[model samples]
Target: MDLITLTGLRVRGNHGVFDFERRDGQDFVIDVELGLDLRPAAHSDDVADTVHYGELATRLAEIVAGPPVDLIETLAQRLVDACLADSRVARARVTVHKPQAPIPLTFTDVSVTMTGTR
Candidate 1:
């Protein structure tokens, strides 16, 4: 299968177990990989023949910015589901990154990844 990958999609979301997290919100970075056959789009040379990435990006941003979820795992799954909404996508892998997590020690980042199939 061919792959369509989108990375470094950043959005501000209020998703955490803490109350302050819900109140203040933090930036979440998401990466998505969609597995699909690109032959139709390649042959037709039309955006309609393939998944519209710009529209997909907008949808994902809305998901991130819409509601509060406690776990990044849930967020990742939601993203995977969104990607699979396109019938052409056979599989999806999503990674949700929480950079400003409430941790005492120093850490570069915290994230969760989820994969789903149609």
Candidate 2:
């Protein structure tokens, strides 16, 4: 299968286990690998033959910035569902990153990666 990857998509959201984490929003980065049979698109050379990555990006941004969630994992699962619903996508590997997590110790980022298949 051919895969199209969108990496390091950043957004701001309220997602965490702590009260403050939910109250004050933080930065989250999302990476997605969309799997599909590229034969049609490759042969036809038509945009309609494959998924519109720009539209996908917009939708993901909407979900990421729209609501508050207690866990990134839950939000990620929602994204997996959306990918499965898209006919062009056979499977997807998604990664959600939290760069501004309020941790006492110094850390670069926290992330969650998930895979789903239709």
Which candidate leads in TM-score? 1
* Residue-level lDDT tens digits of model 2 in 48-91: 99888888888888889887888889989887877777887889
Best prediction by lDDT: 1
Residues 1-118 of candidate 1 have per-residue lDDT tens digits of: 9999999999999999999999999999999999999999999999999999899999999999998999989888888999999999999999999999999999999999899998
Task: Give the poorly placed runs of model 2, Cα more than 4 Å off.
Answer: none
Ten-residue stretch with the least lDDT total in model 1: 72-81
Clash count, one per candidate: 0, 0
lDDT for model 2 comes to: 0.86
Candidate 1 total steric clashes:
0
